[model samples]
Target: MNLLEKGDDKDIEALSGLGIVSDDKSTITKSTIVEVELDLELEETLKKFGLRLESDGCLNWQMDASAHPRNWSVSRRAFNTSVLLALDLYTTAISTSGPSMAQAAMKEMDLGHIKSLIAFSSMYQFGQALGGVVFPPYSECFGRKAVYIATTLIYCLACVLTAEVPTMTGVCVGRFICGIMSAVPSVVVEGSIEDLFNMKSRVWIIFLWACATTAGLVLGPIYGAYISAYCGWKWVLFTGAIVTGVFTLLLLFIRESRPSRLLAQQAARLQHEKGLSYPIHSADATPNLATFSRIALIRPLRLFFTEPIVFVCSLMMAVSWALIYLFAESLPSVYASLGFTGPSTSLAFIPLLLGIPLSILFRIHDQRVLGRRECANLALNPEQKLTGFVIAAPALAVGLWIFAWTVPPAVPHLHWAVSMIGLVLVGFATNEFACTLSGYLADSYTIYASSAFAALAFLRAILAGVFPLFAPRMYSAMGQNLASTVLAAVATCFCGAALLFMKYGKTVRQKSKFAGHSLVVNRATQVKGDNVE
Candidate 1:
């Protein structure tokens, strides 16, 4: 039947502009007429609520949409990003702070064995592994602001428990809870910042975030040593609680940044304002248990095992993370052997701090080169992002070898400064390796980048947590030189990962079901299909 013929002149006039009616008053298919009518109604409804529909009939941000986070002013976005960055720094700092206060904790609680001391750090990392998998989905379900506030508050309480509780078990329990809450910042903050900036603008912001996180690892032990030495180890926990409490208050000023949550809120407001009871659908429906299970738990684990890129990246990152913890465990003994005592032992870690800035400078230079290449119309791929990693991998192996030989019996007369130089190399390589690989993963996975990263975080946190538990014993039994040599050898073997990926990454991605399609291409295809429809 001809659908437009039944409509009044006003309806036909409206339909004519939409091309649902012909100038010759030709017959229009029922399906086409119905679809146009439906689109018009949706558009009218959205317009009434200060929202709009794109050509694809999907709700989208208006031009310069004030409500869209990306359209927020530079100062506003930077302020919010700074808050998240602070949280990231604090969480990472606390992760390593345990080893700094371990001796004080053991003496105060009457704990036996160095393993018991290491547990303070180990348990927190274990909780982080589980929480990394768990919290990201909840943030997806709720808004990022709510998750950040609630977790920060809980973390404060956990810190208080750790500080105040006299029993070893009580402190360990608090540390574990703290780890779980801290995982939100580690895994979700980057995603939050992503909500604030587009792909082209966010690279430097991510770099800053990486620097803050890595700085926390080096700074934690240094400050924890001084804080524990003077104010007592309990004060270390107390300080964390105080800082977190301040940030929790600051969180109140941060608005909801998650797009789905913001859209849902707008929809609810529209329904209320129009005196309508019918549901207004949003892009992200409220996730149910099954959806949550699939996104949060199942998908990450599946990708981790099935994807070669994921496996290799996760393993390499895991080892790098473990090396940081291993250094925390072994550095004290190494320096003490050379007659350093008290906070002086912490001085050895200062060289590690130099690596982060050096790495950042190197990355800045690499980025400029890449920018020039792109400007010259050179084709860039995910493998191209691994250039820094390729350069850094050999340095890591060499650094480990240098440290292995320069310490104690291997080259007994070698100045401690030379060993410190090796540490400088190690620190630089570790930071570069982690940051570059993270970028590569994000590029390769695109739409599923979060899931891929969650997988990486899960495995990395678990292995990082476990490595410290045995580090003391391993260093003792194997001796510093031999054990470090073994580590260097492992690093040397993994150096091939950079070469392998750079050479064959595209071929590998082609075989993978998940990574076979680029997000940009998929989106373009979807938009084209919508236009055709």
Candidate 2:
């Protein structure tokens, strides 16, 4: 007879051992056995949770699961990625939009100093610096889609405020709010890309992301110039709002891409359906307040201060990024001195735009070289990502010097297009440097890549904002040649950072507590295979 059929005092004692209790001796039912089975299943789930479970009973994605973002059809993934790229591009463009229309804004507001004018862009960038540190933890805790929707909606409203509000105070406040909202896309797009694509596919997608960022910087001045020239300066902001509003609507369709969040959601549904009381997710499944504080508030600053690799690389990239803003402030005056007027002055940035695509070609070549090394059974390391940076670093320094020497007063009668060659080189080097350094950080940090990037973003935004404030004054006092020379000298010094890391990167990683273990594991796995053979 079954255990339930043989229910007696001993059987009741056994049921009590399983945490099943009944007071009446003759009232034991079949449902009691089902409850015991569920109890046993829950025990197994708890055991798995203790071991850091990824799956529990029916609450996990199976092989070929249609629910996971990575398993989605290529067309669907591409569509989502495209939407994300567009969002990043437009938001970034807003950072520079004020510079091109500064004169119009200054006239309208009766601003006396160019410093006050620079505040329009600088304030926005300052907001971005803060937002970069503030938003990532929220994304980690809540999910990517929620952050995108909420931020983009506020970003649209901020744009409208900047455009419609009459006071200078109102405009600056709006710009600041816009910057905070825009920072979400800057840092979070990488996480979304991680969700949609695997490592091998990420290279091109990341290159595209780098391209989108640089393109935004280049296009911002061009579009802002023309829009302010014809439709008035207010329309420049109005245009941003209208475009962002459309993107906000598009955001509603994006699936949640954070894997942990998705798993938690799946577990919740199963818990409701099965009526299991035991928790299915692991203890660390959701981010708590402590986790949020550590990641969003403390960790990035700690990494930035303590980690040499993060500090040096981020500092170098920050300076290069700041140069873009410096150019935005200085370029109009530079071109205007050469007799270029109105929106035509913005055309000088076209060469910089051309250089971005060329950098992608170099990136593709670097990938092939790395691919061949992998095919030959060589283990890839983070240092291998430095190949592009090694090439780009010296080019950046040399480009600045070229730009300094080719401009007017240094060479009074030289063609304006000749000066643009330096900008072309600068653009290519800057883009490649950003792409390779970001990849190297990701490879080195692995799971902590987001924190590393947040550190980088924070430093880069601060410098980008500050550099433009001094650009006009620096160019005025030191003259273009000496000012550009000083920048080139700084760039030259940073070139050593790439070389130093390339040679000693493995040694550095070996000593790093937070460094990724994938390379070490790959090396061991390969050795094991050879020994087996």
Candidate 3:
């Protein structure tokens, strides 16, 4: 069956109690923020218990518009995103920092096996794989705010275990648990972005979120090396605990944004207070935890194998992430060959910092393009959102090949400036690719965005986890230049794959009942709006 036939897809439409219905507004709008009208019967039923549907179809106590996260002020939204983004940053730092501590932890804990050391890190990714599948459906049923706050607390506790125990086994278990709990921010923050910002406004926020992820990975070694030198590796976990603890406190202020869950909560509250049950829920049953989990875990794999866009983009991200870990493993030796050691090794990552400001610039320009398109009253598709990826894909290939030829074994240690330039190019292009890929997926998938992300994350996260474990040996045997060249070749091929999707993406999405219906609906609405004007 097509994905639209899946019960989830139909129930997704039941949010506003119509299949793929656009909100009834004649204004030319740029954002997906819908001000859905509640059916009068549904509205009056809620009023009997002093509840009403907000503009997004979420139930709110009568006159309590502030209960909806979308209704939050810009400052409030910014604050909430900052807290979630910070938590996401911490996940990357904790994951990548593991290798830096491996030698020290093995020595102190008397662990004889090198595989155990790899386990300390890779197990986190494995756990994240499981969590990525399991947690998103619950968040879908429960709401993002509750999941973020709840999982963050659990994640903090896991950090405490890892910090206090200091044994390989203890740390590995804690790391795995930390990985599972951290999926809250990893998986749900995108939804939070949707809740908080409209389409145009979200561009920079997402750009910064990507910057923070890359910054965490690039900066992890520097900070981990510092703690290992002076304060000890345990302090690394201690610091993460402290940081996440603060963010968890902030997550408490975030309100529920899932319209379905918000309505369910309202229904339950009314039933408890006045002994009344809602009929709206009978036609569109609230997703129970069990059914949601089954779909969440199984659907991603199906989507990965079946959906062309999701599959291709999944490869794009998987290779991109693997290169990151590979770079993390290889760059240290490149700098060591240049006679830079200690924290100065961190300076090698300055090129990766190039991704940050460059991402912001591209985002600004892309938003301008999107704004112009919307103002012209053009019908927008997710294909339009993918313009950045189309540009970045080949650029990323070029950047990778640049790294292939510039670094060691290819030219007996070229100028540090040359290799750094290669790294900078890769970093910037990767960021641009990220901006488009994510926005396109979110726009195309809509109700299925988180699940689709979970699918993409599985490939990328697992690749990142496993690649570092073999990087040292791979670089040793094939040599850095040849190995990097091979990776570059693979990336170049994947870049082509992405372009194929870009050229034919509309046709692929048109075959998808959900996305295709969305396109028709949007075009009809826009045409109606133009006629009204």
Candidate 4:
């Protein structure tokens, strides 16, 4: 009963014709390569690299060949990662920068209220949610390189529209489009990581990515503030355009990282050249766009509802993300009450960055915990990452409570410094929770981690979109302490999810369609001096 068991993914359904091709072989073993007819030139090329054509007609890299992405030179890997990370940061920053211009746009457009802000801010998030539904599976079908180029181009176009559009209506439209393209990094970047990095190395690489993601969010307000102050609101988008447009060109150089699609292409090339037909690897099927849409769009929603782990973790993450946006929208008022006004409010977001440094400390503590417990995360040990979640969970609650009590406009409001301290704690908690939960999902649903995360992205994006719309009203109704307390209670409630998983996650996985009969059970798993069984 693997938890993430999937049926014939519609992602590949449309490609059955091309994938099966004029000659189809369902099973090809290593020993059968001798019987297959291979192009002489292709054969020569393989030999030159000390590789060979496999019976499956795929390019079989030799043990030491540089053709394997894993074996790519250090410079190549570093260059590729840098390009991908840069693209991710630029795209995400564009999505959040809209708020820096919210007031300016409202004035320029002659709109009086904050409601239209949703049209740009939340709509962009809505687009991001929708993007998650489509892009991850597209990566599985078309390869990461194609998806990156296509999505980045669309994102850059959206930035142009936002910058140049004369009407508020047009800017709102551009924001949604930008948000959709922004999702490409969130949904597909993890799949790219899977393509290049091995298990042991993935943790720290993901840590790097997490930091990059937070950096983008941190950049949004500051970058937008400076641009809006100096050059007006429209120029804020132009700044993103200038940055992302450069990154988009850089995207052209990132080589195909999807192993399945790469091998399929190599095999297809050889077959056409030699007029020889052989079985291809099963994973390389390229489903038609319609089937791809059906599966890609539907799968995340299905997983969001049906998978308990996805449901709980997504809820937790949704709450976290929604809170971040809600706080952003409310920042102007909060600090205004404390006598901080205008663009300086953007600097308030700096506290959110403390999470990056604090997370490094947590990662060190987490690694030490895993080592002392002799825990093998590969052995379906979802609980291995739960410690940080546990520690951070209460901190999130306390932080919310503190913010509620300390933020201005309440009778005898506490110092601004005190409220900021609460923000620091929330930021730290958010980083720890997201990293640990994401790592757990990646480990538990190894094959379907993308979909699991897509569910997370989709749900959180929606929450992030919707929550800010009501944040101001909610604050006005309940005041800071009561409103913060309600939010804190919500955060505290989900913390039980981590506790429950810590106790029963193993037993639940024992019965999962994807993780049941664990492939990893053969490996030793121990914690607290006893073998995990």
* Candidate 3 C-alpha lDDT tens digits along 1-533: 12232334433445435543443333212232233333545667777655664454444445334444555677877787888888888877777776666645767777753565465667777778778777665665566777888788888899899878877678789988988886667766766665555455656776777777777777776767678667887887888888888888888886676645655666787779767664332111336767755555676677778887888777787778667766666777778776788656657777876755666666767777767777887645556556667667777778778877877666774787787777787887666666667766666665566767778778877887788778888878998788888887877775676667768887888797545543443333121121110
Model 2: CA > 4 A from native: 1-66, 274-287, 373-379, 517-533
Query: Residue 533 error for model 4, in Å?
Result: 10
lDDT of 4 at 81: 83
Q: Assess candidate 4 and give its TM-score to the true structure.
A: 0.83
lDDT of 4 by residue, 198-270 (tens): 4445566666777777677666777777788879888877767777788778889888876656656665665
Between candidates 3 and 4, the one scoring higher on lDDT is 4
RMSD of each: 4.6, 7.7, 10.9, 11.1
lDDT of 2 by residue, 1-533 (tens): 24455535776777777556765646666677577777678656533432122334334444344555667788888878898899988888778776876766777778755645555788888888888877765675567888899999999999899878857788779888988888888877876775666544666777898899889888888888899899998888888889999999998997887655765776665557655443433212445777677555776787789888888889998898888888887888888877899888888888888888777766687678667766877755567667778888998998899999988778888889888999998998878877887777766664456667788889999998888888888999999889989999999997888789888877877776656343342222121121100
Rank the models by TM-score, top first: 1, 2, 4, 3
The C-alpha lDDT values of all candidates are: 0.75, 0.75, 0.68, 0.70
Q: Give the Cα-based TM-score of candidate 1 against the true structure.
A: 0.86
Off by more than 4 A, model 3: 1-68, 111-113, 266-287, 514-533
The window of 10 residues in a row where model 3 has the poorest summed lDDT is: 524-533
Best by TM-score: 1
TM-score of 2: 0.84
lDDT (Cα) of model 3: 0.68
**Model 1: clashing residue pairs?**
none
lDDT of 1 by residue, 1-533 (tens): 65545455565566678666775554555576568777778767776554665455445444455676777788888889999999888878878777877866677677765655545788888888888877765665667898899999999999999878867788779888998898888877766755676543444676677778778877777777888898998888888999999999999998888766776677678668765433432433456878777655666787889999999999997798778877877888888877789877887888888987776675676567657666776644656567778878998899899889898866777788888888888888888876777777766665455567778889878877877777788988998899899989999987888899989988898788777654443343221111100
Model 2 alpha-carbon miss at residue 366, Å = 3.2
Tell me how candidate 4 scores on lDDT: 0.70
